[model samples]
Target: MGLSGESQAAYHYTTTRCEWEFYIIVTHTSGPTGRRVLSDKHKERRVGDSREMVELITSNPSALGSLVTCDESWIYCYDPETKRQSSQWKQFDFPQTQKGQAEPELFKSGRWHLHQDNAPVHSSILVTNYLTEMGVKAVPHPPYSPDLVPCNFWLFLKLKENLRGSRFEDIEEMKEAVTRVLDIFTLEDYEGACKKWLECYNKCTEVGGSYCKGN
Candidate 1:
């Protein structure tokens, strides 16, 4: 019922693949999720040249939609934009399609909320005020608590586990593997991740905002 984004490194060399940045929002099975990709620039050696590849990927509307879940909610990649434009897009254009869907409870725009970490880009005054004006609620995230975040606790861990020690001939091959993993992720998998997320949140709170030590 909420949206959030995170970055993961897709390695290029050494037979493994980790990219620079990937942003995702986790929600109920039938809701829209937003994803953003950022290029990884490294000083040592290049992982993969994503500039051209990204340009092509972003240009295709289908590419964006393909990132969605089984419910067919559209996921898009956005470029850097002015705060005003970003606000307008999020408030108006983003939720336009879901205006009348009634079959799935989660697809109802009224039930959707946004959850993201306290990064400056997400927590800026302009962004906060815009969300407030648009009536989008945000899920509170405690600082430095990755264990409580769905992507960190569930998505990324599972993703990396699947990618671990595997060799990819090229960036495209690596990407295909990543896509395969996502494509096969079942609704039950997403639900289980969210379930564990709630458990972790409760665990963190029970420890009085300190690290949750196992019982």
Candidate 2:
């Protein structure tokens, strides 16, 4: 069947009909998770939430004054001055630490709201109860939606850029370096990040929540 779609398939498939078996396997078994794929329902939630955020900000420019975001990530660390210069990446995945449990004093002193994602840790009853007890609010984030998180679009980008190629002895030294970098950012920088958040929400709503990341 030279004229057939099956016959005209890629050479790899033609060689062994291997892709057909792969397709069957894929259909039968769940695939490994890597990148998140947003569903239509997620898009709906993102759009609605984004609109609310825009309106909230529009009605009150200071609405995001206490907003926070997910700022955790793997950072490469090394010290150029020592033999420990071999790259050692530190993975910060402590759910409790991320939810401010580690900084209970700060959260207790003042109300805090987080634009946190719907990860299992963030949504856990423990963290929720803690926030409620601390008089802090948790903004509802659409599932699988990171584009709306300001930290993703702004803070981390700038933070990593400033940290790139810089070396530090250990996690403590790296943490200090990160703090130093953050200290240099002016109020305008923070305001700009907030503005970018608003822009992202606007874009999300504009595109019916189907917008691309980093837009």
Candidate 3:
């Protein structure tokens, strides 16, 4: 809900490796803070795209667990969730994997989709071309659809809630606060996130993609 500062700008990129593995990338930027109002066109697209996601998840159930998604959020000096993030990592490790499954490398060339928001930083022609050249399948995220992303609907909110009201002396202090919150997350936390992710998607489809709570 609320952040701790207004002097610094923080952007977070969250990559969910599996049902229980994920990490965050933080970037600092200079900008304003506020909510984004989606146009009618964007709202329609959110409904259609989320419905497609619902179909994918319903048929496979473990579909998202198999795919790695990336999205950025704006962390104002006070709020650290919005649209300042990127997707350019080589590989990552997971805290845990599904039983009987080998650890997954999200970028095994065509094994995972690179889900990015339509932020200017993410949508640059260079970025698009790079993804195309690398044969990376891009997962489409409708604008103003954080309700469908786990980090937005769950992880970021958890961080804000835990880190709220604390005063960070510097960047290092803020980092420590964030890491503290992350380290305390357990298997149940991540599993719960996956459940919430799908439930939100279902609600999105039900509401015709307007706005759903608890997503």
Candidate 4:
């Protein structure tokens, strides 16, 4: 299976009645074909302003963890000192929801193969070394191929269908709504995605890795 992270920009009304930029990190988890949803993780925080995100990311994109959902009720808290790529991968070790808890962190062992996209952070020497240390194997991804990315073809579109034209009063409200969307996905839904992914993959391979013209 592949692990990928994408950023989404959303707007929310603030206490002062001004709109602010809410940046979220959407982690897509899917089967090997990049179809169907194994699970989805979201990390978000309100930036000082829309422009501030540019500066913040320029300085250190990893700092986005500091804004990650801190409430125990949420899956993962962005801990600057303790959190990093390792912790993100570790979340898969726990059951999605167990004993009425959401994303409870109980360490369990299992074999999970991961393919990460070529983001600067994902490809960095630090991240690669950490993944090697943690025994996670990296799947090679072709450069300049957005269509080959599963999230672009399926996951994000489905998410947009739910979130399009919706408005949130605050970041928390938006988080809750997104959480519901992620948790409500059914196994069959993911299975369908997996099937679609294979179909797309075969088409791409048939063309010798050139972009396919059809949906």
Candidate 5:
């Protein structure tokens, strides 16, 4: 979707947050009509580890064929209805390569691709080369396009708000709490969020502004 110049200031401000120091990845499945039907979320542990990322993708083939979207802290691959991992999941990285190897079948399935902003890790040579070799296409997202990613504008804020003023006994306990929250996210919630996302996108497009609200 395109925005008019009149809203450039708001749009630019929204996009700037896409470059924040940290963020998380979230995925949702969409129907043929472009409505989100499912969701699977993941927290990014670190950056610039192509090998680890390849493993993550291979392990979670159920997310394949979903519209994978993320903010600065997370990256997700997900599908709405399919519960089983794709048989082609094993081919994303080559098996014998030293750096990282993906299975050839994973790319051939044409089910997985990266939709990311131009963050340093997303644009790293290692990441790019590995994706290239794996034949996974990266979506051409404009710099600072937070409107294109739902997490920045909606979910993350809600998630943080839910965690506000809460204390955890330790990192492990915090992690468990976060996991429980994420696990309880029903498909209906994801679809509702996507509907809101489409509304925001339309509003931004109509006003020529970025779709993000300042934090």
Candidate 6:
């Protein structure tokens, strides 16, 4: 879901051809020890490429604090290590929409910050002003680097796996299912996931993106 307009169109033409929708913001928390692992569902989608999966698992947040990440399709925050509160899930309709219009109180925590690649929506004046007014620090991230954010490769895979082998009767049902699955995460799980990133980072530094696995 994180693509520039041109790349997005190209991606659509080459990939499944599904039109990008709302923006999803996901945040994960780690345990006190900072050790976590991806859920069973996450592992399923990552069966083929351990290296890529590990890179996706690196963007682990601390248990005491929170992490914020988003894309054009959805905006959400979660503690990868802990069960998130129901109020944390937020769905945005469009980039032009007002900030905090859907759920003002969610951003009221004021303790959180956002790290996102500079996408058109993310860099938009309206979005920037809205995030500023909401007391969220939006930090710039490197482009074309999903490995920098563990969730892009790890948590997203888990989310997709959780939705597999099942049919959602409707969109509402799917949303409810997402909430239910997210509620079961714990800090320990997130730390396990973070280890994957460390493995990937070491591998890349040592062998230039060559294959490396943490046995």
TM-score for predicted model 1 compared with the true structure: 0.47
Supply the TM-score for candidate 5.
0.49
Rank the models by TM-score, top first: 3, 2, 4, 5, 1, 6
lDDT per residue (tens digit) for residues 2-53 in model 6? 3333212211000011111123332222212121354544333333343543
Q: Where does candidate 4 stray beyond 4 Å?
A: 1-107
Q: For candidate 4, report its TM-score.
A: 0.51
Q: What is the C-alpha RMSD of each candidate to the true structure, in Å?
A: 20.1, 17.6, 9.6, 19.2, 18.7, 15.3
Give each model a TM-score.
Answer: 0.47, 0.66, 0.68, 0.51, 0.49, 0.46
Give per-residue CA lDDT, model 3, range 67-154, as digits (tens): 5655444433344323232232223232432234444455443455555566666788888998889886776678766677776678
> Which predicted model would earn the best lDDT?
3
lDDT of each: 0.41, 0.56, 0.60, 0.39, 0.42, 0.42
Give the Å shift of residue 69 in candidate 6. 2.6
lDDT of 1: 0.41
Worst 10 residues of 2 by lDDT: 17-26
lDDT by residue for model 5 over 22-89, one digit each (tens)? 23322222112122221211111111122333344446755423335555432112212232432223
Clashing pairs in 2: none
Q: In model 1, which runs have C-alpha deviations exceeding 4 angstroms?
A: 1-108, 168-173
Model 2, 27-68: lDDT tens per residue?
A: 111223233677888789989998888887788755776555
* Top model number, TM-score: 3
Better of 2 and 3 by lDDT: 3
